[model samples]
Target: MLFERVESEGLAHYSYIVGDGNEALVIDPRRDCDVYPKMASKEGMRITGVLETHRNEDYVIGSVELSARTGAEIFHADGHLNYRYGEAVEDGMRWKVGRLEVEAISTPGHTLGSMSYLLRDSGGEPWIVFTGDALFAGDLGRVDFMGMDRAEEMAGLLYDSIFDRLLPLGDGVIACPAHGAGSVCAASIADRKWTTLGIERKRNPRLQIESKEEFVEDMAVALEMPPYFKEMERLNLVGAPLLSSLPEPSPLPAREFAIASVEEIVLDTRMELAFGAAAVPGSLSIWLGGVPSFAGWFLPYDKEVLLVDETGDPGEAVRRLRRLGFDSIRGYLAGGMVAWHTAGMESSSIATANVHDLCLRLDRQEKERGWILDVRSGAELQKSGRITGAHQIHLTELPERIGEVPMDRHVYIFCGSGLRAMVAASILKRRGWKDLTVILGGLAGWSSAKCPVVK
Candidate 1:
């Protein structure tokens, strides 16, 4: 048996290609799925089937594109909405590819129709279970996406699916999840590449809770849902467009870029710190690493994207955005930020403040009444007290709720760390709001300084 894990870093998504003899099967593929075919070809295997554990909510699914290329049959769990593409898979249904055996188990917690695929060895012994979003290495999937009213019900379903359906398969089975650390799907997932069911069952926090009611209640806790999730769910149900090739972006000179049409958005893919120092006016600063998860929240799906990265590779940034269905990237800044500066293009910057500075401002009551913009999630704030008089607006919602931020007052933005704070500042600066400052260490820094916090 042959198995390979394909990871999409920014999204923290994992897909698998398992094969034996001559046939291969792809599980939970991303939109830019050409790598699977290339890998299969190098191994002298023909792609035969595609399996989706559930309809994804983060990145676009690549099943349609893969099936188009390889004539592979797409199989997904049958429940909830009727997916326009892919055949509905029921519980206990099995598929065979040479000596490799695949069996689907109904596990509806992450989604109403979630399925966990059990891959058995030639001997018919269960080897590994692809748990999808139902279970992760260290954390379980969030149940909030389905809706607040159904949160408890979904959590209960997930608990049963994990405790009754998945764990009973035995401890030795390797547990391969759809996502890992850095993904929005789970809050406390471990950074490890993959883990076994035995390890997760023993060490995972959610698994340790014995009572189903407690597990359901624990899962109902506050969680931040990214704004783009709704769009992804919609596109996944109807089937996402197949990308024959990745979108190629051209490099445009700074002078030409300066007067270029306003239709295109200038995406600064530089590090948050560098972006905070200086960036083109009205440009959105979402570093290359965050393009997949954050760009979709603020960037329009129709407009062309023009990348501005001085440090990271533009090719990679484009690919990450494309994976999330941002296909109309026209090109990148020809000379990057340095060229923009050399050309004397107008640039904007946000000031950074440490916890000490924040305290001083609070002491002095800084003119116009400074407003603290806490961009962290509600759950984080509840766990760790927030600054007094801070208004909470998650970073993902900043674009639509930008007006809620007071323009007359000095705005100090912050998250668990300074990264999200800088992102918030960039959005405000782009919208022509000035007098912005980012609290260097966010709430963590504030506590480190021994500053008083309001719970």
Candidate 2:
């Protein structure tokens, strides 16, 4: 048998391709579906089927794209929402692929139709189980998306799926999850790529909750649903457009870029420091690395995005944005920041304040004293107390709640680390907040400096 795990960086999504003899199957593919077909070919196998454990909310699903590319039949569990593509698979339904036996087991907790596929070798012994959002390496799926009222009910279903149906499959079965750590799907997923049922059953914290009520209570933590989730759900139900390949945006010269439409959203994909030093005026600075986690929070799906990478590749930036369904890219600025500087175009810069300097400013009570904006999530704040007098607002909600922030005072933004603060600073800068600075090292840095935290 042949197996390969294709990881989508930034999003932290995992798709798998497994083959025996000449036939293969792809599980939970991303929008860029070419990798599966290529992997199958290298292993001397032909792609025959695609399976999705659940309708994804974070990124666009690639089942349709994969089916189009390889003539594979797409399979998803039966549910209330009728999918525009793929056959509705049911529990206990079994099929064959080369020297393997594939069976679908009902696991409806993450989503109404969530299913986990069990694979057995030709000898009829269990091999691996593709647990979608139902289970992760070290955490279980969140059930709050349906509605807060039904979250507990959904959690109960997840408990049954994990403890009743999944654990019975035995310890030797490899557990391949749809996502890993860093994905917004689960709060505390393990960093490891994969784990066996034996390991998770023994050591996974969520799995150790013996009673259903206890598991439900433990999964009751707060979660923020990104604005793009509703859009992704609608698109997935109707079947996302089949992408033959990834889009390669054009590079516009700095001069034309300057005169180009002001309505286009400028994404500064350079390093945070370079963005702090100099950036195209009004650009949203979300360095190349921040595109996945934070871009969806700010970027609108309908608007055209123009990138300024300077030292990095904008193509990669575009690819990451596209993964989240932001496809209307206008292009990247050619010649990057240097080109804008040479053209005599105006640039803007955001100041940085070290933790000690910020504390000193607060101590002196400087006239026009700035407010320390805590952009960390509520959960993080609960765990690590906020700085005294700091106003709390999650970075995701900052765009809509900008008015709540006092314009009269200078704003020094900070999160757990400095990355989020920089993103928040860029957002404020574009909206004409002139007296803004990013607190380097953020709250963690302040604590390391022995500054007091407000509990």
Candidate 3:
């Protein structure tokens, strides 16, 4: 049997291609799914099946697109909401790919119709289990997606699915999950690549709880769901348009880019320092690495996006945005910010301050009228110490909670390492808030400088 795991970087999503003899099956594919077919071709196998564990909430699934490209049959769990594409697969349903047998196991917890696929060897011994969002390396899928009213019910169902259906499949089965560490699907997934049922059963903190009631209670905690999730859910259910159907982002000269920025969303995918130094006026600063995780929070589905990357290549940014269901990319600045400067186009820059500057400013906060805005997550604030008198709003929740940030003060934003702080600054900039400054190195620099923090 042949197996390959493809990891989509910014989203930290995982898709797999499993083959035996001359046929292969792809599970939980990402929207840009050419990797699967290319891998299959290299292995001298034809992709005959595409499977989804559940309706994805983060990135657009590539099931329909892959099926169109490879002539593969698409399969997903049955009895959930009606999916517009793919055949509805029921529990215990089995299919043959080459000489390998793949069976779908009903494990509805993350969502009502979540399924886990068990792949058996030629001798009928279970070798690997595609747990989808049901299980991860160090954590289980969040059970709150079904809404707060049914969170407990979903958690209870997840407990039963893990303790009964999954663990009983035996400890040795290699467990493959749909997401990894950076994904929003799980709060604290392990960074490691490979894990087994035995490893997770032994080391997973949540799995250590024996009582179902306790597990249910523990898993019912609410997490901030991204606004784009609703759009992703809708698109994934009805199926997304193929990549070929979408318009490719072209390179536009600085003069043309300036005109486009007025009508389209301007996204600058450069580092925090570069963005802080100088950027296209009114462009949103997300940094190329942050596009997949945070772009959905700020970008609207209706508007076209014009990108400005430092390398002058918006291909990566476009891919990341498309993965999160942002398909209306108009184009990118041809020569990036340098070209804009050469064209004598107007530019904007956000001020930067260090941790020491923050400390001295805090000493004179009453006279300076400066405010510190912490954009880190609540979990990070709890794990690490927090700055006293700083207003706390998670970066993901900034859009809805923007009012809480005082408009009269000189707002100094800081995140874990300043990447998110820059993004937050851009959000504020777009909202017409002036006197913004990003604290360089953020809390890490504060600690390194022996600054005090409140627990």
Candidate 4:
């Protein structure tokens, strides 16, 4: 079988391709579907099937569009017992490949429709197992997905699924998983894409445990408390529905940029050093230290996009935007802000506020010293401590909690780092909150300086 892993760095997601001699299956494809066609051609295989382990939330799925474009059949498990699918795969349902026998094993922990695939070569020991999101190399799928109550229940099921269905496949079975160290989908995954079941049995924390409750509680502490998860779960009820292909990010000429900026949202994508010296007023800053994800949180879906990559890597910015389906990039800012300045147009340079400013402001407790909004999650606050005088709020809940932030005060937003704080500041500014400032180098920076903590 010809197998390949498709990886996206910014999102830390991995997709895969596996094919017997005749046909290929694309698994967990990224939104743009950039690599599948080339891989198929190289292997001289026909693209015949598309399979999604679970409907993912991190990036848009490419299943629907790819299926529509290629004559590939889409496969998903029937969720619950009576679940239906385009191609319903279930426990012990075996299918034929050139030299391999593939069968499905329901492992519903991460989500309701999760599945793991077992493969047998000729008549020897079963060669490989596709442990979708159920079992990672060193780690296991996060059970606190779907819904908390449901997630808890699923966690118990996950324990049974792993120790019984997956782990019992013997020591020599090669564990070929869909996700690797790159995915945010699991916690503490092994960096390698494949590991032997024997190794996982000996080293995996999930397998070493005996009781279901211990397994459930152990998998509970996965990273992230993202607000987008609920929405992802809603989408996963059906599927993440992958995209077939995306249009190239249309770049605008210098003249077109000025015209578009009148209506478009400006995305400054140039090197941070260049942007720091001279930048656009009201432009969202996405630099090396602060990548586009944080800025993307506040970026609305409908606005026309204007990129500010001076070195001409605006395509990278557009790829990040496309993951959210924000494809309406009117054009890029040609020649960047330098072109605007050359034409004598105005520019705005923002201050990178240090921890000292945060300390002084918190100590003073001035009513008019601008609004102090904390963007750290409740869990993070619970563990790491927060600024004594700052407001307690998570960035994910910002849209709903806008009322708590007074419209009259000069809104100053912050998170673990300055990255998210900038995004929060933009959101407040977009909502008509005037005199907005993002507290650069958030609570971590404050903590580094031994700033006093309230908790």
Candidate 5:
């Protein structure tokens, strides 16, 4: 038996490939589907099946594409919990790949069709369960798919699923889940790749709660759904274009950077992690996933733009840009921002103000000097004690509405942790507004600072 846990840092998603000597199966695959084929060739394994635990509301799933390419059957538990599995499986039903026998355990609290696969080797004790968002290393899946109204019901379902379907398996059953930290699907998932049910049973906060009512409220970490979830869901439902090869990036020459953008498009394929580590002064604050999407939507008119890349994986940022039709990135940051700094180019930084800083500013009445803007989603505002007089709007709407902010006042924008606030600050700066600062640690920092809360 062979298992590979594929992790995508940008999306905080984990996909799995399990195989016997003869066949392989993939679960919850990301859209970049090239590596699987090469692996199949190297291992002399035939790609046979693709499975989706649920219609994911996160990064695009690559199941259909893989199915189309490898002629693997696509299985999704949708109609009356039916699927198109080459080896159909249901609760209590056993599936075999050589010596390995796997069972599908219905654990639907996270999503209606969510599943966990329990695996045993040659009639031996069960070793691991792929708990697809139903359970994580230190957290249970947030009952997000059902929306806020059914929180109680979903929480109850989750309670039953864990008590009956999962916890009974004993300590040795390794818990492998679909997502880890940075995935909005769970409130508090540890970063560990694999953990035991026994460990989670002891350390996991949600597991400690006795009542479903308490679990629902405790699991509510107040996360905004991914901005692209709706579109991705739709694409997943029908189909998305399968890539036979990774999008070929033009080797952008240093001289033709601007003209290439004008002729083709601009992709800022700089790795976001490096961007966060050190950024260009006046750089936009969108140094995370969906950067191309956000940049295209707001700053769409950059016809001859150049990419600002990190030292590694320069193509990553370009591909995302090309995905969104920003393929005109002619070249990188012309030896990167080090070149800019060496040449004495002016660089600036946006302050990450936490909740405490906001408290200090508001209490000291310093907020009057800098425009206090809140860029969290509407859902976040529903239950929070937000800054009293801070102007409320979303990060997506900033470019259009930025003009309303007074130019004379210094601007301080913040969100859950200064992430979205930085995005807003970047958009504001692009439109020529000068005075800007992104509140660090955002509301979390503010709250920890003993800042006043006005719920």
Candidate 6:
């Protein structure tokens, strides 16, 4: 038997290709799914089946695209809602991929129709179970997607799905989850790729709760839902258009790029320091690596996106946006910001201040009228205390709460690292807040410098 894990970086999504003889199966594929087919061919196998653990809310599902490319039959859980494509798979239903037997088990928790696939070896002994969002390495999937009213009920279902359905499969069964660390699917999922049921049962904090009531109560904590989730859910239900069907984002020179920028959103995906030094005026600054984690919070789905990528490889930015279901990529700036500056096009820069500078400004609090805005999440603030006088608003909630930020006062944006602060600075710049400065190194640098923090 052959097993390989394909990781979609940034999103922390994991898709697998499992084969036995000449037949293979793909589980929970990402939207850009060319990797699976190539891997199968290299292993001298034909992909005959595609399985979805659940209708994901974070990223577009690639089941239809994979099926279309490999002639594979798509399988997902049978109920809760009607999916436009893929065959509805009922619990206990089995399929053969060479010598391996794939059986679907209803594990409704993360979603009402969530399923886990159990793979049996040639001898009919359980080998590995593909637990979708229902289970992760060190944490269980969040059960709040069905709305707050149904959160507790869903959490209870998740308790049953894990303690009753999945755990009963045996301690030796290896658990391969759909997502790994850094995914929003789980609050604190471990960084490890795969873990056996034995290890999770022994060490997972969620599993320590013996009572279902306690488990549900613990899991009912509300999490910040990204604005893009509803859009992703809507698109995944009907099946998003294939990558081939979308308009290809072209590379535009400075002149054409300026023309496009008048109508489209300019997303500058350069690093924080580079963006702070110089950027296309009015462009939103989300570093290329930070796009996957924060783009969904602020980017409008209806508008086309034009990238200002300094890395010269804008295709990667395109792929990251595509995974978030942002298909309206107009194009990328051909020569990046340098070309625009050389062409005499207007550019903007955000001011940067170090931790010591911030401290000096705070010392003169009575004289200087500036607000230190902490854009890190509430959870982060709780983990690592914030500056004494800093105002708190999560970066995701910044747009809605923009009115609260004082336009007259100088705004010094800070996040866990400088990445999110740069993003906040961009948002403020676009919104016409001129007196803005991003605090470099954020709280990390301040803490290292032994700066006082209010817990």
For all the candidates, what are their Cα RMSDs to the real structure? Answer: 3.2, 2.4, 1.8, 4.9, 6.4, 1.8
Q: Is candidate 2 or candidate 5 better by lDDT?
A: 2
In the range 1-455, model 2's lDDT, one tens digit per residue, is 78889999888999899898999999989987778888899989999999889988999988888888889998876456878888888898887888898899999888877999999988999989999999899998888888888888888888889989998999989999999998899888999877999999998999887688889899866687999998788777887765545456778888788766387888888777788989888888887788988898998877788888966367678778878888788888888888888988888899987887787777666464567788998878888887777888999999889998877878888886577888999999888888888877755546423336876
Error of 2 at 306 (Å): 1.2
Instruction: Please provide, for model 4 over 1-455, each residue's C-alpha lDDT reduced to its tens digit, 9 standing for 90 to 100.
Output: 77777866666566777778887777767666757877887878777887667656566666666666677887765345332235666677766666666777888887676888777876845877878788888888887665566766888888878878887888999887766774667766777656898999998866887777777777765466554444444444444444433356665666667677778788776544455456666676666334424544555656877778867667766766666456667677666666777877777553446666866765576455565788887767878887666797787678778889998766667676666666566556556766666666645546423236766
Among all windows of 10 consecutive residues in model 6, the one with the lowest summed lDDT is 442-451
Ranking by lDDT: 3, 6, 2, 1, 4, 5
How well does each candidate superpose onto the true structure, as a TM-score? 0.87, 0.93, 0.96, 0.75, 0.70, 0.96
Alpha-carbon lDDT, every model: 0.84, 0.84, 0.89, 0.68, 0.66, 0.88
User: Would you give me the overall lDDT of model 2?
Assistant: 0.84
For model 5, how does the per-residue alpha-carbon lDDT over 321-397 read when each residue is reduced to its tens digit?
43333433445556666665666655555455455665666667633546678887665777776776678878776
Residue runs of model 5 more than 4 Å from their true location after superposition: 80-89, 216-222, 245-285, 288-314, 318-406, 412-422, 430-432, 437-455
The C-alpha stretches of model 2 lying farther than 4 A from their native spots are 220-222, 245-247, 364-369, 382-385, 442-451
The residue-level lDDT of candidate 4 at 24 comes to: 77
Of 4 and 6, the candidate ahead on lDDT is 6
Ranked candidates, highest TM-score first:
6, 3, 2, 1, 4, 5
Each model's backbone clash number: 0, 0, 0, 5, 19, 0
Q: Score residue 46 of candidate 5 by CA lDDT.
A: 72
TM match of model 1 to true structure: 0.87
**Which of the two, 3 or 4, has more TM-score?**
3
